[model samples]
Target chain A: MELLKQSIRQRGIALSEQVLKVDAFLNHQIDPLLMQAIGREFAARFREDGITKIVTIEASGIAPAVMTGLELGVPVIFARKHQSLTLTDNLLVASVYSFTKQVESTIAISTTHLSAHDRVLIIDDFLANGKAAKGLISIIQQAGASIAGLGIVIEKSFQQGRAELEEMGFRIESLARVISLKDGQITFLD
Target chain B: MELLKQSIRQRGIALSEQVLKVDAFLNHQIDPLLMQAIGREFAARFREDGITKIVTIEASGIAPAVMTGLELGVPVIFARKHQSLTLTDNLLVASVYSFTKQVESTIAISTTHLSAHDRVLIIDDFLANGKAAKGLISIIQQAGASIAGLGIVIEKSFQQGRAELEEMGFRIESLARVISLKDGQITFLD
Candidate 1:
């Protein structure tokens, strides 16, 4: 978490009070070593939760989730943002609004992957509005799967995402908690 | 590679002579151990090539590329399928046609990630028509970077993808090569 916070301070660009761009390391461009460390930390935190599978949204979430899945010795399933031609049947879908993109897209997973007997750990790159996390949780619940907890790489503490999920009684573990990105300064929660 | 072939044989679905779905392990639902093995194999093949970075497209390609990046101790960058709010300046863009989706989309990478002095290795999940690979190759060329090779998780040998890239003189390493998917039978090329 310290390393991640340092990376944010050095490489992360504070575009606005609401947006922090980590395209340098965590988003578009990835540091595999950092990802591996994140995976190890998440695994250490939730190792005893009886997690059967790791779930995430496609694109950014896959890296951390896959790394954590490797550490946990489980399979990782990524919810696709859009429906591909190959994926047409037996789907569990949820509508998500991306505050960054300012677009609403449906995230879906095949019902063939998750079931009632499974316990799931949700992971993602950033948690701001919690829309993506909520979407993932909806799909997981539709499959009758139990939620183990939520693992986040970077959480915007100024946002209502964490508060909302915690209100829902989900155990949330965020590695780096950003308290403020005001006046082009990045502040972390103690 | 035999393990990969075995996985394809057991879990891969032959939707048609042109479409083979390995979503059970390779694409949708991913096996981390297999991905680690894949990363190791890619690293072993390109270890002596002086690969400075691992390049891949978003979603499916990220897992294998990250694994390979981890093994080789290099950074991995994935091109975004679409432009987001944060990514609006100094971009390297390429148009890719997805045969599976029957749609054309532009993939872009930030200029900050790639440079003239970098040497890149391209990694992808599947190679059919080679459009994605060609698009990536174009971006790398635009950045004035040298390409070490291409690493593919699965190759449809019957398709023109491998032949076309080979004609362009790119060294390609495909873990599992399928000769045919005719009559719903998944055959591998030796």
Candidate 2:
């Protein structure tokens, strides 16, 4: 967690005091070493949660979910943003509102991947409005799967996301939680 | 390679005459143990490439790139689709035509991460027509970076992908070179 916070402090750029551009190591590009360490951190925290699968969205969330899946020795199932012709099956689908893209996009996972017997750990790169996490939870709910916990890499604590998940009584753990971003400075939560 | 072939033989599903879906372990749903094996396999194949980086497109490709990067002890930088507001200065942008979706999408990468100093090894989940690979190569080209080689999990040998890449003189190594999928029978080429 310290390593991730340091990495964010070092390379992450604050855009307009609201968004942090961590494209250098977290979003666009990735530091595998750091990701592995973050995965280990999540593994240590959630190893006893009976997590059978690690779930995440497409594009940005795949890296963190894969790394965490590697640490926990579980399978990683990612929801697809773009429905391709190859994906033809009964799927658990949900619509997510992205704060960044500012659009409501549908994400879905195969019903065969999730079941009532599975304990899913939802992981992602960022959580701002908690829309993506909510969508993932909806899909898991549709499959009748239990959520072991929520694991996030970087969270904006000042946003309404954490409160929303906590209100739902979900155990959400983030490696780096930005309490506030003021004047290009990042503050961490306790 | 033998292990990969064995896994493919065991778990891979034949959708149609020409479509073989390894989504259970390769893309949609990832098996961590198998991914570890895949990581090692890629490391073995690209051992002589002296790869400084592992690069790939988002979504399905992120896992393999992460695994390969972890195996190689290098960083992985995944190219993102669509225009991101966070990415103010992206250097390399390439258009990739997806045959399955019949849409040409532009994938872009930041110039700061890739440079002439980095030798990138491109990794992907599938290579059908090599359009994605070519797009990735275009990004690398824009940054003036050297492409060490390409490592793909699966390649359709009957398709023109390999030929296109070979015509461009890009050294491509596919773990499973699928020759044909006739009547749900998957065949591999040497």
Best by DockQ: 1
The regions of model 2 sitting more than 4 angstroms off are none
Instruction: Estimate, for each residue in A102-168, the C-alpha lDDT of model 1 and write its tens digit.
Output: 8999999999999999999999999998999999999999999999999999999999999999999
All candidates: TM-score: 0.99, 0.97
Query: What's the TM for chain B in candidate 1?
Result: 0.98
Root-mean-square deviation per candidate: 0.7, 1.3
Q: DockQ of every model listed?
A: 0.88, 0.77
Clashes of each: 0, 0
| Backbone collision tally, model 1 | 0
Q: Which 10 consecutive positions of candidate 2 chain B have the poorest summed lDDT? A: B82-91
| Cα lDDT for residue A3, candidate 2 | 90
Residue B132, candidate 2: Cα error in Å is 0.9
Candidate 1 lDDT: 0.94
